[model samples]
Structure formats: C-alpha cells, structure tokens
Target chain A: MGKRVGIEVSIAIADAVKLARADVIAAYPITPQTHIVEHLSEIVANGELDAEFITVESEHAAMSCCCGSSAAGARTYTATSSQGLALMSEILYHPGPMRLPIVMTVANRALAAPISIWNDHQDIMAQRDIGWIQTFAENGQEAVDLTLHAFRVAEDRKVSLPMIVNIDGFTLSHVIEPIVIPDQEEVDAYLPAFKPRVRLDVKKPVTMGPVGIPEVYTEAKMAHNEAIKASKRVILQGWKEFAEIFGREYNPVETYRSEDAEVLLVTMGSISETAMSAVDAMRDKGASVGLVRIRLWRPFPGPEFRKAAGKASVLAVIDRCLPPGAVCGPVGAELRSLFYKMPGAPKIFSFVAGLGGRDVTVERFEEIVDKARAYAKKRPTELYEVIGVREI
Target chain B: MAQIDAIVGWKDLPFGCHVYEPGSTAKFRTGDWRSQRPVLDKEKCIKCGMCWVFCPDMCYSQTEEGYFEANMEYCKGCGICAHECPKDAITMVPEED
Candidate 1:
C-alpha cells in the first residue's frame, strides 16, 4: 500500500489509471472529462507512465483507435463526456459484441438541442443498448474505486465487455476528496497482465472485423449477450477480492435503509447521493423511505431487485433522461418488468426529473412518494410521469 | 432437384446450404466488373508526373507515348491517381464483365 492523498476524484481516477498501466490511450477532450485525460497526458509526458497516448481529432476517432488497439491485444483506456460520447456512438456497439474490454470514463452530461454542456444522464441513456456494462459512482471515492474495479470486471473471461464508469460531470469530477492511493506493486498483484485469448497477431493469422451474414449474425449477438449476463458473478468476485485488500464493497445495486422501508427510490449515477440524503431526512421525519442505488446498469441487477423490492409498498422510480412515448423512464421500465412474475408486488410509479443539471431537491423526492401513494389507490397504474415539469 | 446453369426464378434457388458455415467461401460476384475504369484523354496530356508521384501504391506506369497508364492488377481501386491528375487526363468509367 502507498501513502494516502487528498485529491479531486478526477485526479484520483487518473492516478488509478496510472496504476492500471494501460498500453494505449486514444481520446479527445471534453469538459469535465478533460481533467482526467489531461492529468494522464502529463504523466505520460513526464515519463511517469510509459504508454502511447494518441490525441485524436474527434470522439469517433478516439473510439476507433481504441477498437484498433484492443484488437491488437493492448490494454486501452479513454475518457469522454456528453457530446464527445455522442460522437463515438457509431463505434460504441462494436467493442462489446466483439468482446474487447476497453475501459472508458463517461463524465455524465446532458445531450444537446438547446445545447447544454452540464451534467445529466442523457448521454449514457442514448447508449443503453450498446451492450457495454455500465456502472455509476455516487461520489469521488467510489469514482476512483469503480474506475479500478471496472477494468478487472470488464476483462474477466466471462464478461469480455467494455465498461463505462460514469461519474457526474462537475459534481464528482471536479470535487476533491480524501482517497487511499495503492502502490503500483499492489495494483500489479491485484490486476495481472491481461492476456487476450484472441488478438491480432501476424505469427498466428486470424480474421477480424469481418462482415457476417444474417445466418451467423444472430448467434454472434447471442454469445455477446450471454457473456455479459454471465459477467455478474465475475463482477462480484472482483469486488470481493478488492474488498479483501482495500475493505471496499460493491454490488450491481446497493440498497440503503431499504430493509424495513415501505417506499423505495431507484436511481443511478451521482443522483444516488442526493437521493440518499433525502432518504435520511425523510426517515428522521418517520417516513419509511429508502433508496436502491444502481451501481451497475447494463446487466441490470434483476434478481437482486426482486430480492430488495420484496415487500415495499410503493416504488418511486426516477430517471434523469426521458424516453419519449414510453410509460416510464428507462430504469423504471426495466424494474417494472422484473416484478411481473410476482402475484402481489408493490405499485410502481415513474418520475423524470433532474435533466440538464437541474436541481432535484428532497421536497421533489417526497412529492414523488406522495404521487406514488395516490396512484396506488387507483387500481390501474399509469406507467410514467414527468416529475417537476408542469402542463399548461 | 435438377441442376441448372442460371436461375430465372425463385424455384431454382439452392436450399439447406448454410451461408455462414465456417468454411463458407461465398464471394460477392458482379457482372459489371468495372465499377471504376480509368480513361485517358489524349488531348489533355501534359504529363506533369503528379499522378505517378501522388499514388501511394505506385499502380501507375508510363506508356510509350509519355502518358500515364493504370496497372489494373496492382491497383486496389483507390482512384487517387485519377482524382489527383493535374491535367484532368484520367477519367473513370464502368465496364461490363
């Protein structure tokens, strides 16, 4: 173990990135995500980290370079935010299905069209179906811890899926916090050198990036799906190992005060901390409210949710991004489907709030509980509702 | 089933053969082979040597008449020499196989 340091979460994440010792990094600069790569660039330039950092023109090229590096059997890392992430949308689907575990950091930001550069869930929401294992950090400490664990989990043999460790744009990315910095030897021992089962090598000729016909395309997709679905165990195992060394625990979905609560709020990314504070305040007032923070979003913790939602009365689902024309937000839709097998499950209500970095206060969360309670009285549960926005 | 040279209808299509078999060697066959064919305009032949110098793959050679000719065997159909010709001497045209 090395000395502890007081640093910003973004810097701490950069330090962890150094410890991982990636062979290649292809990235473009975007706000909030800039500090992470900037620090990494300094490390590489100052000779602290030995790696090839290719500064590409756009996010598309950044992802394209990562695809090339991973195909060449090198451990790769890249960081981007908001628009940069959107630019790489085309190549996002290739890595996971191809089973190349390139780790990435997505400083969560709102999507454009009044063109806001602030934090929100819109960027990641757009890529929900891209097949990457998604995870969110509640604060800077989790941000650093998750960044290191993400590489281990993604590279696990069962889950060769690319991972996106999302921290809030500005909130967690820019905030400084105390963190334990492990020595390089400790990290090397923890994360062994990655040996890709299949890589592009001239010594052994292999065909890659080939176009597949419809006859075998579905099978390839199914294999990718099964690999990610099986990755849950690998993810837990990696966390267990990390816990042994650092004493930090992780799960797909982490529950806070949900053991005896009547109402539960489910969310992802940095909003969980805000939601947790609200839960604590509400609990003090004798309101039986709790939170289900989804740290892993891609292979969503379905079985765990079924266990956590055991007997809660009303489940208030919150989403930062709107899935237009759908009954509820994305997380809400996924959670509702998990309880379809139960005969008597709690009534579920959806809320779309905190978009474009808008403030989601404790009062707003309490109001959502009230709405869920009211909606439960009526037998027919309307699927989703936008929380703060009012109709004219 | 009877073997046929060419199919005029769906009835002659092969059945039960998987297209994505491990050793499937099916290649895209086209009748109009020359999706791009280089043409030389004799009137505009200045022979500046720009096209030959700019070709990354050196697929062009000089004809006895001092004009450039494209070697189809080595040309990967990049169209760079034709597009970069200073005299507009090279033109691409489609040809039938």
Candidate 2:
C-alpha cells in the first residue's frame, strides 16, 4: 500500500523518478517543464536521491548527455517542453535506434512562431514519428504513474527503447492533486534494476550509432520499426506489473461510459477529463455519448483503439494540435486513415480544439459531440471541422 | 562487396545499430577509396614522426626500427602525411589499377 498526499504534478513526477532510482537526470529549464527538473535537482542535492543532475546548456545538450549516460548503462531521465522538445528533436531520433532506454517527460505545450508558454499537445505531437513510445497522462496521478511506467517499459530488455510521458502543460504540470506515493519496496518489487543488453565500456568497448550506408540503411530502419511495434507486449507487461503492485489499473486505450453508446468523443491528455464530464452531462439528458481517452500514443495501439471504437456509430476525435493545411488535425487524420478500410468502423468526425492554451470546457465538448452527431447524419465531404473558430 | 557481406553476416551486425566488437571499422578497408597512395623513402627518411601525427586517416604506423609507414590497408591516400613530412621523405604517387 502507498500513502496518498497532495503534491504538484511536476513534484510528484520528480518524486516518482527519485523512487525509480534514476542514475542520471539531464535537463534544461523550459516553461512548464522547469519545475520538474528543478525538483529533481533539489532531490539530488539534498541527498534524498543519489543521482547525477546535469544542468545542460540547451535541450539538445541535455538529450545528448542523457544519451551518453544511458549508453554507459545508466538509468537516465530528462524533461522538456515546446521549443525545448523541438531543440532536442535532432538527438531524439538517435536514442531510439541506439536502443537506449531513456525516459523523458514532455510537459506538453504549444509550439511557437509568436511564442506563448501555455498548454497544448503541439510540442509532443510534432515528435510522433521519432520512435519513442509516447504515453499521455490525463491528470496528476497518471503523470506520476506513467512516469514510473515509462522507465519500467523502456528498460525492459525486450523493449530497450526510449519513451516520453506527456502531461498537458500548465493544466496538469502546475496543478496540485492527491496522488498515491508508492512505497520504495513496492516500486523496487515492480521495477528491477536496469540490466543493459549493450553498453559503452572501456574494458569491453562497443560501437553505437554507426553510420548505416545504403546497403543496410533500409534493413536498419525496418528492424527499428519492428522493435517498437514488438514492444507493445513489454508495455502491457509493465502495466500489468504496476497494477499488481499498486492496485491501480491502466490501459493503452481507456474508456468511460461507452459500452452501449452510439456516439463517442475521443481525446488525449488533460482534455479527456473535461470530455468525461461532458459525457456524463449528456448521458443524464438521455444522449448516447461516451469518452475514449488514448493513453498510449506510439506503437499507436491500433488494435485496442479499433476494438474500443468499433461499436460506436459516430466518433468525434478532438485534436489539440492543428495540422495546418491538412484535411484534419493530427489525431483526427490518423484515426481517419486507421478506420478507412476496416469493416464496421465508425464514422470518424475530426474536430480541432484547445490549441495554444485555450480552455476546452464541458460545454465545448457538448457542442463538439452535437456537431459530430449532425455530421454523421449529413455525411459531409470536408476533411474535418475546426471547432470554436470565431466567425468574422 | 564480399567484405561487406562478410561483416554484415556477423551475428551481431544484423541487430540494427549495435556494434558487438570494438574497433570493427578496422576490418572495413577504406584503402579501396584511394586514388593516390603514399610511399615512404626509407633511405631519405629522418623518422621525425610528423607524418604519423598529420595523417588524416591515422593510417601511419611505426615500424620496429621507429620509422613510420602508411598502412595502405586502411589508408584513403589523402597525402596529408606526404604533405606534412618535413624531410620530404614521403611521396604521393598515383595507384596502378
């Protein structure tokens, strides 16, 4: 059993990492992600956690340092958001193919040309294809649990791939909530010490990240693709172990009140909580609406999503990042393509909302559900609809 | 191509980006890229070791008698050693096909 205490989500995540007994933490301060590394630094400095906290010059350097440490057989972690994630983008691709189990926290925030430091999914969404196992946390507890889960899954020998846990920027990162702080014994029982399959050592040297010439480049990429897709088993195993120890169940795709509903609102990150309330309210008034929150984003969890969403007659996928000039937002576009050929798949209506720190309220979700229901009936040819757009 | 096939056939080579053995590139003979090769004039050589320090490919190795010679197996024949040799004891010559 674990003790429940009220703590800021970022602080809880830092504590979770400390409990996980990370060997190295390298990060640069970025809005919304600053508090996480700051807390971790204090934890290391105070001797509560015996770890190396590297204050890197930039997010690029932070990820580079993480790569070096993780390659040297250390359990490594880092946190970044928005431009920091974009800055680290160059090195992000290296960890996946190098097969280093680096755990990172992306306090999801909107990207910038104008530059606003508020909450959105744009930061993490832009990094979808980087080969990291991405998991979205709906709230503070999920933030802590998923952070620990990420380390467990990443370090699994079968997986040995990097992972990112996305917590919606100020919305979740800055919020204080009651969360279970698992006992060190329970955590130790759940997560074993990282045993690296390959590492950089002076005594037994090995090359990592070698240039793949034309002859083997395609084969290398194909192997990487297979590794990530195959990691789904290890991911589920991690979750199963976590549930056994903590008694808190988690799934790749979680649902609320969707068993018999004909209409479904699909969401990721913090907005799913708001969507849940909207579903409750609509159900009270005799509306057949439900909520599907995608927890695992990478390796896509396609089969789980198909099973969860197959029964619904109409599905409204609310995307937080606008995939500019595309027919739909990123999540919407993915869902559309996923279901395009599947027999008995629901009609997926794409909706873009809550971008750039905009609040997605229950009423807005209600409106989105109504719009999706209407669109299902009319069957419009448009790619997707941008919700809450101001009419001139 | 045969050498590449042999290296690629190594058990650990198939595991994507992993390098199972250290210094595996030593087996990859980059000397094949050479259009020009460096020849050492043992009689004129002063054994200053400047060529050893200046070779871009680190292909220059010391003989048992302390004279430096280019290990043509891995040398790309960049001529850096010949260019930097103070005694003009090393010369760059075109390789015969």
Number of the top TM-score candidate: 2
Q: For model 2, how does the per-residue alpha-carbon lDDT over A1-392 read when each residue is reduced to its tens digit?
A: 88999999999999999999999999999999999999999999999998999998999999999999999999999999999999999999999878899999999999997797999888888888999999999999999999999999999999999999999999999999999999999999988999999888888867788977665676678778888999999999989988989998999999999998899999999999889899999999999999999999998999999888858999999999887787788898889889987888899899889989989999999999998888988987787887888999
Root-mean-square deviation of candidate 2: 3.4
Report per-prediction Cα RMSD to one decimal: 8.2, 3.4
The DockQ figures for the candidates are 0.04, 0.34
What TM-score applies to chain A of candidate 1?
Answer: 0.96
TM-score of chain B of 2: 0.81
Count of backbone clashes, every candidate in sequence: 0, 0
For model 1, how does the per-residue alpha-carbon lDDT over A1-392 read when each residue is reduced to its tens digit? 66677898888888999999988989899997999999999989999998999999999999999988987888899999988999999999889878789999999999888898788888999888999988899988788888889888877766677999999998889988787887788788778787776777777756655554444455566667777788889888988998877777888788999987899988887778878888989899998998888888878878887787768888999998887787778888887888776787877888889988888888888888777777888754457877788677
| Native-referenced Cα lDDT, model 2 | 0.90
lDDT of 2 at B74: 80
Q: Which regions of candidate 2 are displaced past 4 Å?
A: B1-3, B7-16, B29-55, B58-97
lDDT of 1 by residue, B1-97 (tens): 2122231222221211112234322232221233576777889879887778887656678989888876664454566777888888887766542
Which residue pairs collide in model 1, if any?
Answer: none
